[model samples]
Target: MKHFPIFLAMEGQKLVLSGGGDAALAKLRLLMKTEARIEVFTADPAPVIVTWAGEDRLNLTARALQPGDVAGAVLFYAADEDAREDARTSAIARAEGALVNIVDNLADSQFITPAIVDRDPVTVAIGTEGAAPVLARAIKRDLEERLPVTLGALTRIGKRFRRAAEALPFGRKRRDFWADYYFTTGPRALAEDGPQGAEEALNTLLDTHLNAAPRAGHVALVGAGPGDPELLTLKARRALDEADVIIHDRLIAPEILELARREATLIDVGKEGFGPSTDQTRIAALMTRHARTGAQIVRLKSGDPAIYGRLDEELTALDAAGVGWSIIPGLTAASAAAASIGQSLTQRGRNSSLRILTGHDTKGFAEQDWAALARPGTAAAIYMAKRGARFLQGRLLMHGASPQTPVTIVENASRADQTVLQSCLATLAADLDRAEMSGPAILLYGLAPRAALAEIPQVPEAAHGP
Candidate 1:
């Protein structure tokens, strides 16, 4: 790491800053939140700074930073636009034993200011180690959306109750108390009656939880949308954040998995198409086992769990074991694939209905109504189709599917590394092999990727001979 992250004790400390431009104002905006007494030195101070000083917001002086100006300062910012001035001011601050930051100068800065999401007492600071400020700001924005504005208020209330909660046993018991308060009781009370009601709710929660048995765990079957973490539904993300245990598929993206709670137990129950696989029974057993132990379990799947995800089998097992569970739908590969190609699954004057088919199943090479699927204007998205590409090609061709029918193979849909190969039904197998595509791909029949940046090779006009 280029720099270490530390939260300084700013109470009764001094913060020195220089400059009168936008940079100074930007730093001042965030620095105003700190408990430190702020001092600004500038030859020509901005009017806003003078007004702030008049209002007792900060101490402003109209002069260049002199020696001893940074005495006893915990932090200093040289926001001068001129490099020479910044260098000079930073030197004076450093001589006084204060950590100095030169605005926009990473190499010369002793510390970098992170993009911060402030909720008063609840603050989230994201740093890219002075590498990518834009990326850091994007992350901060995402967190701003995920976190509620009232979180700080709830945290403040929780802080007041910490003494009372200490009556409970430390470690797991205390953690459970906080968890229940934050996830359920606290939010519910705040919504129903506002912050004042939350206090009563917290007290009731403490009393009930302190006297009651430990919480019983439940299961959440969450669909981690096709590759891209941004495509994940709000509910799915919540399930991951609250999960005590995450049982994920092999195809689930690492970025998506990173969203899970840091302390959560992550189990890779990945099953391969024709390779090593986890037994279905074993997966269900794991779910029930974790739930029975009072752990909040999340069964994380790659795409929508309803389609070709063997969802019924797991649901049956959970039901038989008397386990409580809920499902969070995700954007299936089909929808993502369709989006990648800039086309809808069903279009006007084209296909009126859509079908989702699996390339293979427990019996191997899933059997479907090829005659119905081969009809003109029929649209279908075939999953697990990589290995069974040839089987699908032969069946569709034999069932009167036009050899010139448009086919688009979307690999790693909605991901940074996504690839789209456009071809005809006749050359689907050959095109897939030539592409050397390896990611989880979906095959689209009667659909072709629209004009985009991708260099899609044109399908031959003449159909290949059988």
Candidate 2:
């Protein structure tokens, strides 16, 4: 970023501006709002500048800017309406150890001002690093219209009662109390009885929150939805927001993890297929352990947790520990993979049913009913099949599966790095080996890319001829 936005404490600080025309007047109006000692140096003084000086809003020097004129100033502005003069004034202020701003000259300025939406203590600054001032101003206008004028008063009252509200407890409880006050109680009280009523309402709200019974612990099995933050369900996002501890899988996206509360503790319980991994029993134990301590825990899984995610084992542990749990279903990777290739899991006249299979199980190279799977019009989404491709190929081929049965491998489904490799049962293992794909993938049997359908007739010798 050319300019990093930050709130400078302007109260009782020194600020200098070397301009007297429209530029000077514009800056002075904003400077007057602050408690800073503003000194404007300009030979041709504008009428408003002189008037503001008379009102003791700022100090005016009716002369050209000289060396050391902006000494010790926190911020100095050179808006002289002339490029040559602004450059000269900026050089002087910068050498004097003050941050200089050449108005309308972003390339030379040390800082650029942002358009602000002011609600007193609640100020929102919109900046584009001097790239698009119009867009910034538009956003500011929208925010100003949406924000209620009484919001400042509500915040001020809430600020005064913050310490008293602390008796309600920290984390979600405190957040909930504030949310209630701002959205419901505080506004209603202020409308009915003004500031005094709001203060009284805060006290009543705090008392109710303080006397409320502490909430029980829970474990939510949340699916992160194919590595896309936008694909995450609202319920899953809420679970992350309220969770005191997050236990996520290896495939869970960092973008999804970023949704969790900053104070929430993160525990990685990722397991790899045919590689080093966290023990499943230990993962369950961690969940029950945290939940038993009255902490809200989220077992964040990539894709749908129920789909080959060993969810049953975790639930059994939770039940044995007598900990409450709920499931927030997510978009499974198979669905995303199908969408990427423009195909469906079950197609009329093509497949009557769908199967979700794991290529590897506890016993390794998980076995499926080879006879049933070899039949035509059978569709399956095979997970963890990269290493077991040859096993699956040999089994299906031996069981009379057609060599030309279309199969597609989708790697990193629904993610930015997603790739699709189209092949048939005969070449499934060889094609996958040639691809050398490292990311998690899903293999779709009895499906071909919809785009490739048009070329099917022309490529029959390669894709479909048996």
Model 2 residue 2 distance off true place after TM-score fit, in angstroms: 5.7
Q: What is the lDDT for 20 in model 2? A: 92
Report the C-alpha lDDT of model 1 over 306-366, residue by residue, as the tens digit.
8878899999999999999999999999999999999899998878899999899888999
Weakest 10 consecutive residues of candidate 1 by summed lDDT: 457-466
Worst 10 residues of 2 by lDDT: 457-466
Could you give me the TM-score of model 1 versus the true structure?
Answer: 0.79
* lDDT tens per residue, model 2, 271-328: 8888889998899889988887789999999999898888899999999989999999
The lDDT of each candidate is 0.90, 0.89
TM-score of each: 0.79, 0.88
lDDT of 2: 0.89
